[model samples]
Target: MAEEQEGSDAGSEEVLLTPAQLIRSLEQAWMNEKFAPELLESKSEVVECVVEQLEHMEENLKRAKGGDLKVSIHRMEVERIRYVLSSYLRCRLRKIEKFFPHVLEKEKTRAEGDPSILSPEEFAFAKEYMANTETHFRNVALKHMPPNLQKVDLLKAVTKPNLDSFVFLRVKERQENILVEPETDEQREYVIDLDEDSQHLIRYKTIAPLVASGAVQLI
Candidate 1:
């Protein structure tokens, strides 16, 4: 019985990810989803896998002794990695919310035609997680009023193409207007508002390439 109890405890032990390992895992997940979102499987799995690691890091931070320079530096490094992980996940969540809205189903088994982007194990974990926390995707992500997005969020959004979506940008270089209509004002500049930093409102596709080349920045 003692041996069996020890085995059970061992099986339940959590795996801790090193700060570097967690950053790499999160970044890889983000890049894969960024390039081929449709092909990327188990979106939440990618994020959820690091939850324990994040928690462990947080626990260490909470108890960390102060005044030691080494400890202070290490804590900042951990915090930076934590921020990266969070920003990566937030971007992915925004993509999921915009593109794959079906996975958040709290009611009814996952609907047809919406592929289980998560593996069977991951799906099971998510179902259990949501039930335990009473959380939906919106609650985790889209809830509450508008607030300042992290710097990375703005950077990622501008670089990615979201057709039919409106975005704010500052034009550093000029490109031919593809949306020009016949008899329209020739060389008419497009300005959404009076703000000098953000004067253009254009479809994402029109400016995506330019933004990728540092010709524009999302405001």
Candidate 2:
């Protein structure tokens, strides 16, 4: 019988998923976040589940012989998972630091029932980052400026992600009628069907919705 792992969705519904499936989800989320130009929605559930698994494995390892080959293998596996988890989080933090103002604005203005793009902890980090950034700006340059020019608009100052940038991705689900924009005046926009398991190099903006819906995976 297949083992069941406890998990939850954004809607707070409890779901059963295998450990392997959970890791695959994390890997997909990591890759998508790594390649996407802009920040994507938070996968806190997967992160938490993976962290919990790591803790359980560490606890089990504590009971095993230190030099056992099986122990060593498990240790290495744990390390690999930790690396992926850390890298995923670091990628997100880098994006958050790069675009904290816009991130905060999005969080603030999102509809009441909509899911948040940042986890609660990430939200806190973004707010703190914004505060420190503004303080640094004021002390380093804004304070020295004439009163009329002292005010700064962070949204205008910080550059947003280039949605038009090209990204490599593999289709996870068959999608029909994806619109591809023209490159030049002579070229015309056209629609194309994306077959499942097919890979393509395309503009991020053109398939961003697919990425959000898990219909495509960034390669």
Error of 1 at 18 (Å): 6.2
Poorly placed runs, candidate 1 (over 4 Å): 1-22, 35-39, 101-115, 118-219
Which ranges of candidate 2 are over 4 A from the true structure?
1-12
For residues 72-149, what per-residue lDDT tens digits would candidate 2 score against the true structure?
999999998899999999999999999899988988998876667899999999999999999999999999999999
- What overall lDDT, based on C-alpha atoms, would model 1 receive against the true structure? 0.50
- The Cα error of candidate 1 at residue 171, in Å, is 33
Question: Distance from true position, residue 44, model 2, in Å?
Answer: 0.9
Q: Please give, for residues 60-92, the per-residue lDDT of candidate 1 as tens digits.
A: 767878787877887787787667666665665
**TM-score of each model, paired residue for residue:** 0.37, 0.91
